[model samples]
Target chain A: MTSIINVSNLSKTYEGGFQALKSVNLEIKDGEIFALLGPNGAGKTTLISIICGLVNASEGSVTVGGFDIIRDYRQTRALIGLVPQELTTEAFETVRQNVSFTRGLFGKPKNPDLIEKILRDLSLWDKKDERIMNLSGGMKRRLLIAKALSHEPQILFLDEPTAGVDVELRKDMWNVVRDLQTSGVTIILTTHYIEEAEEMADRVGIITGGEIVLVEGKEALMNKLGSKQLTLDLLTPLEKIPESLIAHDLRLDNGGTNLVYTYDSKSDRTGITSLLNDLSANGVKFTDLKTNQSSLEDIFVDLVKQSS
Target chain B: MNLRAIKAIYLFEMSRTMRTLAQSLISPVVSTILYFVVFGSAIGSRIQEIDGVGYGTFIVPGLIMLTVLTQSMSNASFGIYFPRFIGTIYEVLSAPISHLEVIVGYVGAAATKSTILGLIILITAGFFVDLQIAHPFYMFLFLILTSVTFSLFGFIIGIWADNFEKLQIIPLLVITPLTFLGGSFYSVSMLPPFWQTVTLFNPILYLVSGFRWSFFENADVSVGVSLSMIALFLMICVLIVWWIFKTGYRLKD
Candidate 1:
């Protein structure tokens, strides 16, 4: 995929001398679900704001759809839609009016058909004429998406769309995002929910302390940093691991009833055969064995931990 | 030009006024009526006329100017300030709009509202006082210029203000006071000599004098000076608004 959004050596330093973003560089593919993952105060929102033209960068530059964000602001911003983290709607405005207003702000002609479709897709059609203040938290969150999609932007930025949202709604939003991606809209999201990134992103990026620690395909990241574990539930509790099996990395779990062995899932030599033989020789009997592969969350935790 | 965007903003603001019609329209109109009923009636019947006009007729232009000044500022200030307060300003900032378009949409809506309110009050004032428009064109031109200029000023206040209290500070403490002391109820000639000299310095005086001259062709100051003062003030407001967008001041960080 071609790069549709490019950030070249971007930095943002606030008036109070708080450096929100370091010298950062990134590129988002033309049509992909890219998740920017980070902990609290990791500058995720700041980066997204700069690209959307909501915040000015102190140094460096960004371009959306090959148009410079600042010099061709109208062209760049016209191609993008932003759902900010804040649940900010015109409280007095009806749902339909709120969504339709955004279409105009994004320079799109009024199209009630498109507005109806968006509201219906988000399950907000029934509440179209109702005041926004009357909607539930989940509905309000969906309204943000509907408003963002009003102008049919080629790219959408979801800044913590699922934050403070319930699980069912989050899953529902994940599906909506998937549908958006299928419809050919590139999505870039900033989130602290690692699972959110895992469940939706084609590529995952980990940021820590204003810097990107790593960016890779979700599966590649999991495989690269993910470790697997084989837990041996023994019939007899061992006093200790015998010295003969010392070479194999092992640990006692469940108060000595289980002997767990950990190894890189990607590595060819797991040494399970040699460890089993050595275990038998030492009378370390096991009734059952089960293997567990690490998940993206595990890799993310490790990556963030290492960076910070 | 972003005319569609401008229309959206303009209609959205007008809709807000429609939603609260009592407050936006009726309340101001009622207050103007009260001023006419009491000050223009009870007081005017006893006080002598000034500049060959009845006391009731003399205050008509001042009342409209007072309404336009406060309404323009509050309408425009509140229009922009509410979005910033609620955090919907992000949508505005990220929209594909130029700063001029943003100002035009907001200030235009504000000026429209205030001008309409001013006109409504003028019609209402005629019921209480004998009204005349020596130059109808200048009457409208002065009203519109004052509205647009003060609406821009209110836009600045909206951006500068961080809280509700700050929003009310300028319009309430500074502007309302200046309007009252700047001959809203009496002619500048009625004030003592030193006070008259001091009142001449109030910008609202020029606005009031210019607007009054459009009606009665009698003003405390020359129409040229009034026109120049308003033009200078309008230019200054435009300058500040430009700086705000260029620097991203309180709107962005």
Candidate 2:
């Protein structure tokens, strides 16, 4: 995929000298769901804010669709939509009016059909006439999304999209994001929810301390660093792992009734077969065995810990 | 120029006035009527005329100026302030529209509303007094100029303000006093020489003098100077707004 957004050596320092972003460089591919995973205060919001023009970068530059964000702001901004982390809407305005208002602000002609479709897709059609102040928190969040999509921007930035949402709403949001990607919209989402990234991202970028430590295909990232564990349910309890199997560094669990062996799942040979043969040779018999692989959450936790 | 974007913001702001129609239209009308009864009828009975115009009719322009100036400032200030306070201003900052377009949208709506209110007050004053227009063209001109200028000033106050209290403070402490002392209730010519010189320093005096001159050919200053004062104020406001957008002031922190 071609790069749709280029952020080169971007940095942002607030008036109070808080450095929110530090020399960050990122390229967002066209029509891909790129999830930016970071801990709180990791500058996820700052990075997107600069690209979207909500905040100014202290150094470096950003280009959206080959247009400089500062020099060609109008063109770049016209191509993007942003759902900010905060739930903000005109409290007195009805849902339909607010969304239509946003579309107009983006310099788009009024498109009632398109607005209706977005409302329906977001399950907000029935409540289109309701004042935003009266809507539930979840509905308000959905209205924000509707406003962002009003102009049919080619790129969407969802900053902490699912921060306080329920599981059902999160699922619905994921589906909406997926549909947008299918329609050729490039999506960049900033999330601390590791499972959210696992569920929706095509590519994952790990950011910590204002720097991107890694960016790779989600599958490749998981497979490259992912580890698997083999567990043996022994026929009888053993106080300790046998001397012959000490080299494998096995772990005992459930009062020594279970034995666990860890290995790299993607390595040429999991070293499992030899371990099994050694278990037999040492008379470490087991009634049953099950292998388990670590989740993306594990990989993410380790990466963040290492960076910190 | 993003005319559609400007139109959108204009309509959105106008709709807010519509939602509070009674407050926006009724309050000013009521205040004008009460001022007529108290100052025009009761006071005019004791005193005859300010110049050639009757006491009741003399205050029409001043009354309208008072409301328009205050209304324009308030409408414009709150129009932009509410969005920033609510955090929805992020969309505006992120939108493809230019800063000039934003100023046009917000200040345009505010000025339009106040101009409409000024006219409504003019019509309302007609019921209480016999009003005359010496220069009908200049009447509308001064009315629009005052509204647009103050609206721009109010736009600045809205952006400069960090909190709700700060928003009310400028208009209340700075503007309200100036409007009253600017010869809105009494002509500057009636004041003693020293007091008249002090009143000359109030910028609003130019606006009131010009607007009233349009109605009765009577004024505290020449119509040219009055026009110049309004133009100068407008230019200052325009510069402040330009600086606000240029520096990203309180909006982009």
Candidate 3:
């Protein structure tokens, strides 16, 4: 598969010696939802700003669809849509005007049919004639998406698209994103919400301290780094772990009401049978047992902490 | 620069400016009337005609220019400054619009406002004093030139201003004082040699004198010199605005 975005040795050092982005390399394939997850000031916005040509890169080369972001700015920018984090639209302008004007800015001729499709897809068709300031926050977020998609860009950069929005609005935005992906538009989103990535992203990238620590397929990352925990509700409380159960690496919890056994989910054998046998052999019995898998949030937190 | 985008931005800005029709259009007209009442009628009663024109008529061009200058300056400054204040400037910067398009849209709107106020003041000054139009063509030229020039200057002020206070500083401190001392209500020939020479350095003096000369057949200062000075001042303002847009001073950083 051809990479739509190729970033190499990207670093940004603002004036006054504040280093915002370290040397980072990343490649996002076309028609995929790639999520960049990070803590605040972890260089997520900075990276997006550099890619969108909002801020100058101190040292790096970024190409969108084989065109340099700085050299072929007009062409590269024409192909990319940037939805900034701030809700910065003309308050006095109607929603239709706002979106159409954005398309015109890209030197695109007026296409009313495409605009109607975008507005309807984002659930903003009914509010098209209303002033932007009159719309609620959720409607405004959806309008931002409509504006970004108005020009039919190949690559879309949504910087915290759902930040501070209600859950309903977030779901609406996600649906719009999925629709775009189905239409073969590559999306790069930076978000603090882990569930958003877990629900939508095909590939995940973790940025920490101005560096991209890791990037991998979502399922593969889970299978590779994910852990499984087997918890047993003991029939009786135990003062301590018996000598025979020590080899199983079982943790006693809830005053011996629960016993946890951690194992690699990817391993062919979970060793659960042997662990149960060992626990029973030590005169311990369980009334019920349940197994749980590590979530993306756990993995993300671990990756960020390890890099720091 | 896309013409469509420029038109869209221009129309959008103009609509917002016109929304407050009462404040935007009325305030300047009212203030101009006050200027005519206080400076023209009251002050002219004690002064003699200069260069064969009534004192009231002599000050008419200056008062009109003053209204245009201040209105142009405020309109341009506020147009750019408000976007920054409300964090909407980022929307403009992030859009695919070029810098030239942005400036054209904003400066065009500011010029339109100044021109409107100038015409209003001209119409209103007729009620206070009898005005002359020795060269209506030059009069129109001067009005347009002054409007465009001051609007450009105000565009620079908008870009350099860091806050609301900074936005008001240029018009309040610099443009206002210069207009007062630019031989607005009197002829430069009446002043002493030193003061006359000193007034020559003020750019507003050139604009006012040029505009006033357009109305008088034979004014103290020759119309040719006044036109040349206004042209020179306008060029300087354009260069300053163009440089700011090119270098992205206080904009890109």
Candidate 4:
């Protein structure tokens, strides 16, 4: 797959010698949802801002659709849509007017049909004529997405799109993102919400301390680092692990009513058979057994901790 | 030249002016008429005439200039400043429009509004006093030039200011006082020799004198000098704006 956006060794150092972004490189494939997962102040917005031409990078370069962002700024900017983290919209203008004006700002010819379609898709059609200040916060966020889509940009950058949003709105935003991807628009989103990235992203990039720690397919990343836990409900309570079953790393929980054993799923040999034999040899009995796999959140926390 | 982008910004600004018609248009027009009623009547009755023109008529140019100066600056300053305050300026910054297009659109809309207001005041003055334009062309020339120049100046203030207090500081404290002291209501020549010479340093004097000369063919300073001073100021404003965009000062981090 061809990459629609490329960042080659980009770095940003703000005034007073504060380094916001270290030397970093990334490439986003066309028509895929690439989620940048990072903590606050990890230069997620900085990277997006430089690519959108809102901030200049101190070193290296970026290109959108094969055009250098700084050299062909207008061309690159015209191809990208940015939904900023801030809810910034003209309060006095009606929703329709605000969206239409953004189209004009990109030097795009007026297309009422396109504007209407975008507003409708974002569930803002009914409130098209209402002034923005009158709209609710969720509506306002939808309006921002509508504005970003006004010019039909090929790449969309959503900087913390669902930040501070309620669960319903976040779900709604995820659907909208999926629809955009279905229409062949590349998506790049920055989020601190692990669930959001896990739910939506095709590929995930983890950024920490002004550096990209890892970038991999979401499913692959989860599978490679995932661990499984098996819990056996004891027939009766026990004081401690018996000497016969001491070889297996097991912990008694629930006042010794449950035996919990953790093992890596990726390993060829899980040692489950050996552990079960040892438990039987020790005369330990279990009424029930259940297994759980670690989620992306656990992997993310572990990865960040390891890197730090 | 992205005409569409410029039109987008220009129309957006103009629509804002329309939305605040009472504050942007009516207030200034009403205030200008009050100046005619109070200063033009009371002062005209006593002084009769100054520099061979009726007091009411002589102050007409000054009144219009005062209104135009303040309105143009306030309009342009507020037009740009509000976006920064609301953080909507990022929309324009990230758009495909060039910096020149942004300036032209904003300053153009502001100058257009101020010129309209100035003309309206000129017609309103006709009701209170007999007026004639010695050089009709120069009247409009000075009017448009002043509006555009000051609008540019206001744009600078908008970018330089980080807060509401800073936005109002220049227009209220500096520009207003300078307009008054620059002989907006009276000729600078009326001052004593020493004061008159000192008054020549005031930039506002040239703008008012040149504009007044366009009306009655009378001025405190030569027309050429007045025109050149305005041209010089316009150039300086342009250069400063250019530098602002080039360095991304107060705009990009």
Which has the greatest DockQ? Answer: 1
Task: State the lDDT at B129 in candidate 4.
Answer: 89
User: For each candidate, what is the lDDT?
Assistant: 0.91, 0.92, 0.84, 0.91
Candidate 2 docking classification? high
lDDT of 3 by residue, A1-308 (tens): 78999999999887778888999899999889999999998999889888877777888899999999877777788888888888876688899988997887667889999999999988899999999999987788788888888888999999999888987777778888888888899999999998888889999999989999989998887675568899989899877888877888788899978999999977889898898778777778889999988777777788889988
Docking quality (DockQ) of candidate 1 = 0.81
Q: List iRMS (one decimal) for every candidate.
A: 0.7, 0.7, 2.2, 0.8
Tens-digit per-residue lDDT, B1-253, candidate 4: 7789999999999999888877777888889888888888876679857889888888999999999999999889888988988989889999998889999999999999999999998988898888899999999999999999999999999999999999999999999999999988898878899999889889999999999999999999999999999999999999999999988888877
**All DockQ scores:** 0.81, 0.80, 0.40, 0.76
Flag clash pairs in model 1: none
Q: What ranges in model 2 sit over 4 Å off?
A: A229-262, A266-268, A275-294
Off by over 4 Å in 4: A229-269, A275-292
State residue B244's C-alpha deviation in candidate 4, in Å: 1.2
Q: Any runs in candidate 1 off by more than 4 Å, and if so which?
A: A229-269, A278-293
lDDT of 1 by residue, B28-118 (tens): 8999988888888888889998999998888899999999999999999999999999999999999999999999889999999999999
CAPRI verdict (incorrect, acceptable, medium, high) for model 3? acceptable
**Which residue window of length 10 is worst by lDDT in model 4 chain A?**
A218-227
**Per-residue C-alpha lDDT of model 4 across residues A1-308, encoded as one tens digit per residue:** 99999999999999879898899899999999999998888889999999998888999999999999988889999999999998988899999999999999999999999999888878899999999999998899999999999999999999999988988888878888998999999999999998888889999999877789899998897775577999999999999999877788799999999999989887999989999988887889999999998787777777778777
Tell me the chain A TM-score of model 2. Answer: 0.85
lDDT at residue B227 of model 1 (Cα atoms): 97
TM-score for the A chain of candidate 4: 0.84
